[model samples]
Target: MGLVGRVREGTRPPESLLLTAPGERAYVDRWDCDVAAGIGLAHLIEAFFTSKAFRAERLALAAIGRGGTDGEALLLAMGAAQNFAAWTQVERRENEILLEDFAGRTRCWLAVTPSADFTTLSFGTAIMARHGMHAAARSENLAFRALVPFHRPYARALLMSAAHKAVRLRQRAVSGG
Candidate 1:
C-alpha cells in the first residue's frame, strides 16, 4: 500500500458486521505504513480522529446533530475510549477495531499488524446503500452513485492526513517533546 493505502478488490472478513447482502455492496481500501517509533492501532486511531480531515468531517457531522468529540477524542487519544460521538466500537482486538455509525450505514475497520521489524496499519470502510422498490437499482442508489467521486477522494484524504499525523506524532514523541 502507498502512504494512504491501496484500493483493492476485497471484501470484509466473515466476522465483520458490514457484510454485503444480496442487494448491497462493500468497498475495502487498505493503507500500510511502517513508522520508526512503531505506531499501534490506538495511536493511529487518535491521529485519525484528531486529524484535519477528520475534524472537518466531525464538525460537519456536529452541525447536523450527529457528532461531538472534545472528551471522546481525549479518551481515544489515551487509548481508553470505544464509543466516539459519531460511531461505536462494533468489534475490537488488541491491534484492531471496527466501528460503525449510529445509523449503521457505514462501517470502518482498522487493523495494525506487527511484523518482525515494521508495523503495518490498514484502514477500510464499508458502505451499504439500498434503493427503493426498483428492478435495476439494486446495486447502488442515486445518492451512492452521486457520492462516488467525492467519497473516494475524501477517503483517501482522510487516510493520508491521519497517517501523516501519526508519523508526526511519533517524531515528536521521539524528540522528547
Candidate 2:
C-alpha cells in the first residue's frame, strides 16, 4: 500500500489559528492518512519525529533552538515534556495533542482516529506570522499566504514519511519482529 495523506473537501481544521483576537491574521491547513488500526498516538509521534524529513528539521531546529538530537526520545515523552525545541505541548489527550511555538505565531495539532480496520492520522498547522498591528486583516495575510504553497507540500511529506513508518511498525507488530 502507498503512504500518502489527503484533505477532504470542505472540512476545515477542527481548531485553528483562525480563532484569534482582533488584528491577528489567521491561517490553517490539515492532512490525513490511514494506517494500521491498532496504532496510537505514541506510535504516531515516534514515526513523526523519526521520519527523515522531520529529522532534518529537528537537526536544524536543534542548531538554533532546543537540540534536535533529543529525537524520538523527546517526542515520545510527551507526558513529561512541556517544551520540545521551541514548541511547548499545550494540550494532551488520549488521541490528540496541540503544541505551540514560544512566540505563539505557530501551532501544530496531531491526532489519531482508529476504526475497526485502520487509524486516520491527522496533522494540522495554524499560523499568524504576517500582520501589522494597525493594518486591515480579513483572513490570512500575504506573508503567510505566500508560504502556503511550500508549506503544504512539506507538511504532507512529513506526514507521508511518518505514515510509511507507521505501516512498517504495524508490520513489525503483526509479525512480532
Candidate 3:
C-alpha cells in the first residue's frame, strides 16, 4: 500500500475537509467561493488540475529550483504532477471529493465540497510535516515551514481560479457551446 493508502486505513475522518494530527507540525487551509450549480466533484478535480493557476504555481516552484546547489535540487524535486495520482482517493460522494498523499515526511490531504445550494465550493488542504531522512530533507521541511504563512492566500487564489474554470465549463456544457 502507498502512503496515502496507509493513512486511509488509520483513524481519521473519512471525509475530513482538512488534514489531521500525527506529525511534527500541521496546517489546514481552506478557500470557499461560489460555483455554478452544474459543477460537481469530478468537475472540480478536473478543473483544479488543468487550470492555468495550477500551472503557474508549478512553474513558480520550478523556478525556485532554477539556481542553487542542494536547495535548488530539493525544491525542483517537488513535482506537482506526482501528487495527482499519488494521492489515494479517500472519499467520493455526490458533493465531496477527498484525496490524501503521504510522501517522505509530508502527509497531505485535499478536500473539495460543494454547498447544499450547489453554488458554493469549498477547497481545503491539510499538510503534516515530519522529520526527514537527511540534511536535504530537513532543509526542505524548514523551507516549507518558513513558507507556511504565504500558503493560505496562494491556496485560496488557486482554488478560486479553478472554481471559475469549472463554472465556465459547466456553462459551456449546459449551453452546448
Candidate 4:
C-alpha cells in the first residue's frame, strides 16, 4: 500500500509518501503531513465515541477534504481541525454543509490556520458541544499523561477516568463492556 494508505492503517507517515508526483497525481501523499495527523485525530475520536465513529470519520474526512493540507495557500496548516469539525456537521445533516466551490473552499479552510502550535482541542470541543457530546472523562486521564510535563497529576487521573470510560463505551459498543 502507499504510505498514505499505511498511515491510515495506523502506521506513521514514512518519507516515501512525501514524494511529489508532479504531473502524475498532481499532489503526493507524503507532501502532506496533516494527512497522518488527520488519521491520528480520527483514531483519537474513534477511541472516544464508538457510537459516533461514523461521525468522527466524517469529521476526519471533512478536515482533509481541501487538498490534504496545502490546498489553500493562505490558511495555517492547523486549521484543518476546524474543517474536520465543519465537515462532520455537514455530513451529519445537523447543518447545511455547502461549499460554493468545493476545491476552493477546501483550500481556503485548510489555509485558515498558519501557526505550528495550533491545537484543535478547542475547536473539536466546540463541535462536540454542538453535537451535544462531550469527551469521556477518560480523555482527562490521557491529558494527564499528556500533561505530565505540566505536573497536574490530580487532574490527569480525573481525565484518565474519562478516557477509561470512553474506552469502555467503545468496548461495550463492539462486544457488549
Candidate 5:
C-alpha cells in the first residue's frame, strides 16, 4: 500500500502469517531485501560481461555494500600498495586514521587520510601516480571506468575473470600484443 515494490504488498496474505508471531516473520522479511539484491546483482552481471575479473571485484564490493567510490578506492589502494609506495602505513592523529605512502628512493611522501572507507585506497593510488608508475597506477582506474558497470546476472564471476584476463591481455598488448 505504501509504494508497491518499495513495500511488499499483495492482495492475498499468507495463511501461515496469521499463525506466526509478530517477531517471527521479522527475520524473514529482513532478509528479503538482501536476497533480492543478491539476485539482482547476479542477473545484471550475467547479462553484461564478456569476462570475469570485472565481475568478481564488482560483486565482492557490492556484497560488502560498496559501489563506485569504493571501486575507485580499491583500484588506488592496489596500485599504491603494490607499485608506488615502497612503504605504506596508517597513523592515528586526533580522531582520524592517516594513510601514508613513501616513494622510498626519492624520499617523497604522499598521504591521504580519508574520514570515510575508500579514501585511503584512492589516496594511495594518487601516491603511486605521483611517484611515476603510470601503468600500475592506472590499472584500477581503467577497470573501474571501462569494465565495472555491466550489471548482469553472472556479473560478479564474469567481472573477476574478465578483469584478470583483461589486465593480462592489456599487458601483452602493450608489450607487443
Candidate 6:
C-alpha cells in the first residue's frame, strides 16, 4: 500500500495533442499507487473526480476567490478559475484518460496499469502558459518561478494526499462500508 509522488522532469504532453507551445515552461507532477485489484481507467477517473480530495481542492479554489490566504490561493487565482466540469476529455484509452481545458492551456492524465499482484494507478498534470496576451498565465508563471523552491515537495504532498483519498475510497467500496 505504498503511494508515491514525484516531480517528473521534461515530461511533455502527447504530440498529437496541441496544447502547449514549443518553448513554453511546463511542470508535471505525478502520483502512483498500487491498488489491490485492477480498476478500469474509467472507474479510476470517476473515483478521482468523486474523491474527497478533489472536492476539497475545488472548495479551496472557491475559498481563494472569496479571499483565502497563503501562496496556494494566489497561485490558484493567477492560474484559472475552478471548473472541474469544464475540463474536456481529449483522449480515452483502455488504461488512460487525457483531459484538457477548453482553452487548452492545462492538461491532466489518469491511468491504471494492471500488474501481476496489483494495479498501478497514476495521475499527472501539466500546466503551460498560454500564447498571446495572457495576464493570468504570466502571473501564474511568475508565482511559479518565485515558488520554485517549494514547488516540488508541495506538489508531491498534494498529489499524495489525493492518491490517499482515492485509495481510501476504493477500500471502502471493496468493503461495502
Top TM-score model: 2
C-alpha-based local distance difference test score of model 4: 0.25
Q: What is the TM-score (0 to 1) of candidate 2?
A: 0.77
Tell me the spans in candidate 4 whose CA falls farther than 4 Å from its real position.
1-151
Residues 42-107, model 4: lDDT tens digits: 222333222232334345655766222222211212223333322321221111111112322211
RMSD of each: 4.3, 4.2, 10.8, 18.3, 21.2, 7.9
lDDT tens string, model 3, 1-177? 110110111224434534433344455555666654556655566666556767764465447542123222222222222234335445444566555653534333434445465555566666666555899867876787788778766777667677777777677778899
lDDT of 5 by residue, 1-177 (tens): 111112111121232222121222111110011111111211222222223444454465457554234334333333432221122334322212223224221111122222322111000011111223588645644553443233222323333343333334434545796
Worst 10-residue stretch by lDDT in candidate 3? 1-10
Off by over 4 Å in 3: 1-17, 20-25, 58-91, 101-118, 132-138
**lDDT for each residue of candidate 2 in 69-155, tens digit (9 for 90 to 100):** 445344444565566666777777788777777777788777788888778887777785564565554344666677888998898
Q: After superposition, which runs of candidate 2 have C-alpha atoms over 4 Å from their true positions? A: 1-10, 13-25, 70-78, 129-131, 134-141, 173-177
Q: What's the number of clashes in each of the models?
A: 1, 0, 0, 18, 34, 0
Clashing pairs in 3: none
For candidate 4, which ten residues in a row score worst on lDDT?
A: 121-130
Candidate 1 local lDDT, 121-174, one digit each (tens): 566777756556885555455666677678767876777677778778777787
TM of each candidate vs. truth:
0.75, 0.77, 0.61, 0.19, 0.18, 0.59
Worst 10 contiguous positions by lDDT, candidate 5: 25-34
TM-score ranking from best candidate downward: 2, 1, 3, 6, 4, 5
Query: What is the C-alpha local distance difference test score of candidate 6?
Result: 0.55
Clashes of 5: 34
